[model samples]
Target: MRSSMTLFSTRTLPLISAALFAFSFSASAQATVVDLGVANGYSAFIFGNIGSSGSSGFTSVGGSIAAGGNIYLDNYNVGTNKKPGSAVNSMVAGGNLNTGWGTLSGSAVYGVSNPNATLTAPQWFPTNNISKGNASTLDFAGAKQQLTTLSGDVAKLQSNGTVISQYGNMTLVGNVNADVNIFNIDASNLHNLTLDLSSLKSTASIIINGTATNITMSGGFDNFASFANRTLFNFANATTTSLQNVGINGSILAPNAAFSGSGDMNGTLIANSVSSINYGHVAMNGSGFNTVNVSAVPEPGTYAMLLAGLGVLAFMRRRTPARAPQAAMA
Candidate 1:
């Protein structure tokens, strides 16, 4: 009986271990949703760090500005002053700033209120009434992690006449002549991808496979206005992504990536670091732009797997008999 019990223990232990392993893997593989928190209050600009060379450009940001690093606005105009909904928005910075001839219209500026902090424009929110650190209140790290997870999650990929090319660590999915937009990408499992939209009218929805990958966009997007309501770009797996002279239509989710661009983006920009140079402008979507609402519900498949594992463990425990008590002789 003792030998039989030992064998049973050994067999059951391995089965339990396997079940636990599967359960853990399923839980970890479950998708993660990022919460922007108060950072979403700003509709225009959000960045982990921002630096710029002094240049005069007619760049306009339609939403609020939140920065983890110092903001250097060199001859730039932020926020509309006349629009009824456009009350001077909020500007929250984790660090100090030197507004060099740039104007920001908002209720007030929040964050580190150093005495030496220069503010050329009038502030509705007094310096003495500074709020908490904007960067600390935000979960940039979690967002980046979500992106990394997304990179590991690939749904499906359909290619046309395009040839997948590799440039060092980067992967290019389309070419100039090929109608690269013919490829349908189900981002549910897409890891890292660099899509060339040099000759495409529209692109399919890209579900993010959150991973620590990088994505880049080259060329222009003419049909962006059509899909402005849908999510056009999702780089939840990328650490860094760049946009060069493209007109973006949908929401872009790159919570971990440092997004730098010189084009006009018409959507939500969520990232660890965001910067723009050479007349780059961000125009938020009126309906679903810069709202800090994220629901991280586990996928149905994940829930099913988890439940099945638990059920197996319960059955195994039921099958195992309890040790019987031995009677002592007087």
Candidate 2:
């Protein structure tokens, strides 16, 4: 009896305690995740430069802009769609800000002192929206690392939605009840696709991971703007990603891809470089890529602990002797 009690205390109890603790911790703890770190606030977060496509001289942005390289602009208007109380700088250039003429609704910061000699500087609207600073405002190098990691991480998620290809068109349908709806598509098959998100909940996030070397999103993705705030398009393996004519709804996460387009991108634009772009609008839905955790899965070690605890209880039960029957006399 003493031996059994000792076993229960020394081995079984600890195992059971550990198992319960691990399981409880795993069940209660949840990781709160955000898509982009500091880059989320920008209309365009480019690792390289932001230049005009030579076709359109008027480039407008609804939010703040950040670039690792130079910002070459002929006629740029920024911070048009920003919140009235937003105090952040409208432009943060890691290299230089070369502009012939433009108006910034907010302050500007640049790394290089000298802009293009042809233009003195970009005009600041409201007169009070002028704040000049050096290049230490934003960490572009750090943003590059985080953006690359996000691209790869989002791609690893298993697809929960179906990508149906029929009649030379692709259709994406998602489960409305699901917290996250993931879709995987190749650049080859994503032509004239329609976003059937009528069933999806407004708060649920949608992740579209595209695999290709060179990807062009044009004509497809009708009505993507309505769900753009809750959507993220991750092009992890692309070297070049271009948008043409159509209005882009979601944020583009292409860390290695050179982003160019004559279209209007309405969400957070993260890429290696952006050139010849037309419009970069801040996420319209307000909450860009909102993700919520509905359930939690225990870790491998936690499962092992639980199993071990149950096994010990079973072993102890088998080892213990049964109590003999006693007769009562009247």
Per-candidate clashes, comma-separated: 27, 2
Q: What is the RMSD, in Å, between candidate 1 and the native fold over all Cα?
A: 10.3
> Model 2 residue 65 lDDT?
77
lDDT of 2 by residue, 1-330 (tens): 777787776787787877677777866575435458777787777888777434322278778777887677656677777843232887777766666566677677776333431223535524354344543567778778977886787776667788888877788888888877789998543467677867577667777889887988877677676677778888999998876666677888889988776667667788887765445322221213444343444566767877777777778777667666888878
Clashing pairs in 2: 52-276, 53-276
Give the Cα error of residue 181 in candidate 1, in Å: 16
Give the 10-residue window scoring lowest on summed lDDT in candidate 2: 280-289
Q: After aligning candidate 2 to the native by TM-score, how far in Å is the CA of 199 from where it should be?
A: 3.4
**Ten residues in a row with the worst lDDT in model 1?**
286-295
For candidate 1, lDDT tens digit of each residue in 1-330? 767756866787677768768776765565333333333344443445554435322255555565655565665555643233332334555555545555556544544433344443335423443344444444444544544454233212223324343442223243344322223332232323444445333533323232336666654443346545444355545677766656566556566677676666655566666656555744443323322212234556867876787787677668777879999988
Q: Give each prediction's root-mean-square deviation over alpha carbons.
A: 10.3, 5.1
Model 2, which residues run further than 4 Å from truth?
1-32, 52-58, 84-87, 112-132, 277-330
